[model samples]
Target: MDIPRSFRKTLLAHLPYAVNEDFTAADDLAALGLNSMGLVQLLTDLEETFGLELPDELITEETFATAGSLWATVSELVPAGQFSDA
Candidate 1:
């Protein structure tokens, strides 16, 4: 699935160092400066923005490893018919 624009905006906001880079879905977020604290904040932001609670099982390092992985997780949780480019 494609990453939602809102999701990208939220992800970019947490990645301070990556703002100027041409980051892609496969880019390593950690290398882009997404530390532990940033990850937590990102999680909270994503949850609140998407209006969905991430299940414990879904909270894994792999899930947040890259933008694509994170988007995959969010796409799975977003309510059907509610997803939009915005």
Candidate 2:
């Protein structure tokens, strides 16, 4: 589960309960041992890392089921028009 350093660090820091290998988009995020409190922190860290204000529409269970999926969604939501700002 070697991924971008930033993603890996962010995942480890935020989703402390989740492991790096849970890269699929169907893995239970909660099964990884996350609680509702941790999920909020993870979202905040992800938003800060990617520089995108993610709407709940993209934060659904289907979209954030795993580490890889979370990284993909963040990469996709990142402001393509301005990387510097991000």
Candidate 3:
């Protein structure tokens, strides 16, 4: 599976805001209404879904400021070619 696409879908499913396909990678999640609790939930879901144990340092506002930024972090944690198309 495409990690970024999956992550984006998961995030949108949990978000209280109405994010559409028009949403870009540079869109600020906080500004888009993703509060702390939502962020925590997103993190938890991501960890469970991806079977990842994210380090504390990786959980930062800067790292999750945008979809692309968060995807970058995931890309770093999950090695390339590890994610499957299924």
Candidate 4:
């Protein structure tokens, strides 16, 4: 599925560092210059964007590394009755 542009925009805004990285693809979260705070903010943005109830486990490096991966994870974790910011 084609991911929403809002997801990308929100992620970049919270990134607060080099906004030029190709975040659409899988890359190291640390390599993208995201510190712990940045990652927390990014998690908030993702939660708001997708309306997913995030667990602590979902906030790992692998799950949130890429826009595509993040969305997929959210889609999986977000339950049938879970809200979507649609």
Candidate 5:
């Protein structure tokens, strides 16, 4: 599966009203209504799904600002093509 797409799917699953909406890399999660609890859930899901641990320092407002930014952080820790199907 595509990492970002899977990420988006997981995010939408956690959100109450995001089922029909289209999400993009540039979309701001905060503006999309992701609160503290949602963020915590997202982090937990991301870690579990990707099998990677995020550093404390990387869990900043800016890091979760947008899908692209979050993907950048994930990519840094996960390495390229790790989640891409062969």
Candidate 6:
């Protein structure tokens, strides 16, 4: 399955240091400049974009470690049939 375009766009907006468009799912977001402050803001952006709230237990360093990991966690929270290629 592909990551939602909204998710990708929102994530990219917060990643100030991201150098290229080829960033992969396993890429480290922090290395791309997603610092602690960015992460906090990202959480809010994600919730508002997806219209869902991530549980407190799900908010952890591991969940935000990589793009793929974060997508996996988000994919689980959002309703099925919501992911699209657009």
TM-score of each: 0.88, 0.67, 0.80, 0.64, 0.80, 0.89
Model 1: runs farther than 4 Å from truth? 20-22
Which runs of model 5 end up more than 4 angstroms from their true locations? 1-3
Arrange candidates by lDDT, highest first: which order? 6, 1, 5, 3, 4, 2
Q: Write the residue-wise lDDT of candidate 2 on 1-86 in tens digits.
A: 33466666666665555566434445566767656787788889877767778898887776666766776777777765433322
Give me the runs in candidate 4 sitting further than 4 Å from their true place: 17-22, 77-86
lDDT for 70 (candidate 3): 83
Q: Pick the candidate with the highest TM-score.
A: 6
Pick the winner on lDDT between candidates 1 and 6: 6
lDDT of each: 0.84, 0.65, 0.74, 0.65, 0.76, 0.84
Weakest 10 consecutive residues of candidate 2 by summed lDDT: 77-86
Residue range 1-86, candidate 6, lDDT tens digits: 35667678888988888765556789888888899999999999999988879999999999999888999999888877766654
Off by over 4 Å in 3: 1-3, 82-86
For the record, the alpha-carbon RMSD of candidate 1 to the native fold, in angstroms, is 1.9
Candidate 4, position 82, lDDT: 44
Deviating ranges (above 4 Å) for candidate 6: none
RMSD, one per candidate, in order: 1.9, 4.4, 3.0, 3.9, 2.9, 1.6
What is the RMSD, in Å, between candidate 2 and the native fold over all Cα?
4.4
Pitting candidate 2 against candidate 5, the one with the higher lDDT is 5
lDDT of 3 by residue, 1-86 (tens): 23355666777866566456445778778877788888889899888887787899889989889877887787677756655542
Superposed by TM-score, candidate 3 places the C-alpha of residue 32 at a distance from the truth, in angstroms, of 1.8
